[model samples]
Target: MPALPRPATGPGSRYTARAATTRTRPTPARAKPDIVALARRLTARDLWLTALIHEHRVLTAQQITRLAFTSTRSAQRRLRTLHHYGVLDSFRPLTVSGSAPEHYTLGPAGAQLLAAQAARDMTDTLWRPTSTGRIAYSPWLGHDTGVNELLTHLAAHTRHHPHTRLPLWLSENSCARRWGDIIRPDAYAHWTETTPHGERLLPFFLEYDTGSQTLARVEAKLPGYAAFTTATGTAPALLIHTRTASRELALRRRLTDPARDLGLRLATASLDQTTDTPHARWWMPLEPTAGRLTLTGLAVRWHPLTPATGLEATDADTPLTLPVPPLPPAPHTAP
Candidate 1:
């Protein structure tokens, strides 16, 4: 007669008394938060975060925390706020172990904000970020981020250690402006490490290698470095960071080739050496006679790098500044 309707066996159907189950509830991701509402809530601190992302071009979540925030938890909340309001954009690379770190780049709203701060037309400059920001996804992102990792490590170390300071941290682009024709070190920095004896300035040209280039290609850059040192009369140490132990060994051999007879002092180390506690990292001098040198001890290991000029010579190529110890933190008062 009227056949009974088929039993609904699907999970949502009323086929059984049982209900679907999950171990735990997961937080849902925000696809796109209310842009206008979030825009109205932007704070001065948020603007500073945008400026930082703009200046660095690319920074990991951890790096951002180091740059601005006191804790990762707070950094996450703030980054989410900026991302929702379109002032910051982020991407994570695929990884084998654990989750990937979210790397941030300045977004359209950040560009507009910067333009407005400078009293410039947003139409032209605001759109510039799209052209500039896509670099976070470029193939070289790994290498670029690796280079920046070294910088962030040094900056963080400087913050904690009283005896050390990173006074001048210049990006590769800034180095290009300063020494473009001669040689552009991936970066240029003045490291001042104090001891009971005295503070020493360890200024060096950083060459962060990702092991993508052949040893031959690496050697090709040596002559430029040698020439730059000779011209400046300030022997800025040429510091090379390789991706692996084998890569470091290969690079060290290239640095030792007497046939090249490079006048510059070369130091080689693997990425593992500098990832954490950068101050503890060792840079093995190309000279077999010299042992691996710690970050603070570079002055003793590479004495030649220090300008020979007398203290009266203010015209020194790169003037070293006195160490500035971190100021004591303010006392917390009861709320």
Candidate 2:
């Protein structure tokens, strides 16, 4: 087993922008709203979305809808209301073809509420008035949103499928807090499917690529994951989602030897191949001539992979907290 490498945290995953021009909305200038009043009026989904934005840093309006709402209009209307109330802040990045959807981040009131819920100060949430501006102009905005979209789609899929649940979805920052020393995956997730036979769990580290990095740079990250598996004594599958079919193919060719040599269970998928219902058979194993497999199918293909640990309730009390619980609190029913 290889020794764990020194903590080599890279820049946040780059969501490369294609636009030469960007239009950023001015930061909100209103005084901080009453946290008590805001907290009392927030809906179940509102609080959940707030915490999610704080956890993930940013999510586009469409991504939010997939995770929380039934319709685009309703999601937009409610998100606008949240923005007006200072519970959420949003900005749109301009693109060559058209304007991008609104990207949301935690606002002052939302930060206060989340901190109060966690029994901490607002600073503990790491939010500043300029947080939205920072995220809006981030070079990696596209990459972050891309990574988020994949999980949001999966979450949406589970909403209509009674037999499945996405029990865990941790953003890159959360993964860094736990495993930054050895590896920095774009995101981490735990999924489960309950069938007649039994419950199957698929816990994975997501590497979302935008084709900005060279194939060698991409394959270079494998050793870190290898060391992480050795250090933790757990081997979570590494699922790499590429931006194009050609890139995916080239990457699989480049990574096959290194991944196999490290005894890593890895899979590849392309954005072009994944539909809204992402659980379909889109993922191809790194091995040659292997047919594409569904998300859960990959789990079964690599049986006896160690279940994700250190995410127990007791682990959340540290200075670095656990990721927000995957599912939102149940909607409040009228008494």
Index of the highest-lDDT prediction: 2
Give lDDT per model, in order: 0.61, 0.77
Off by over 4 Å in 1: 1-48, 96-98, 119-129, 258-260, 304-335
Estimate, for each residue in 77-102, the C-alpha lDDT of model 2 and write its tens digit: 88877887778877766554434677
Candidate 1 versus truth, CA RMSD in Å, comes to 14.3
The C-alpha RMSD of each candidate to the native structure, in angstroms, is: 14.3, 5.9
Clashes of each: 0, 3
Q: In terms of TM-score, which candidate is strongest?
A: 2
**Tens digits of lDDT, candidate 1, 1-335:** 11122212210111221111101112321233333454567775676556555555677888767755667898888787676556776666544334446777766667667666655666633345354435633556666666777777777777667678876666676566467888877877778888887888878888877665677777889988877767767777778887667678777776687324876677778865555655574788777576777866777766645631222323322211211112212332111
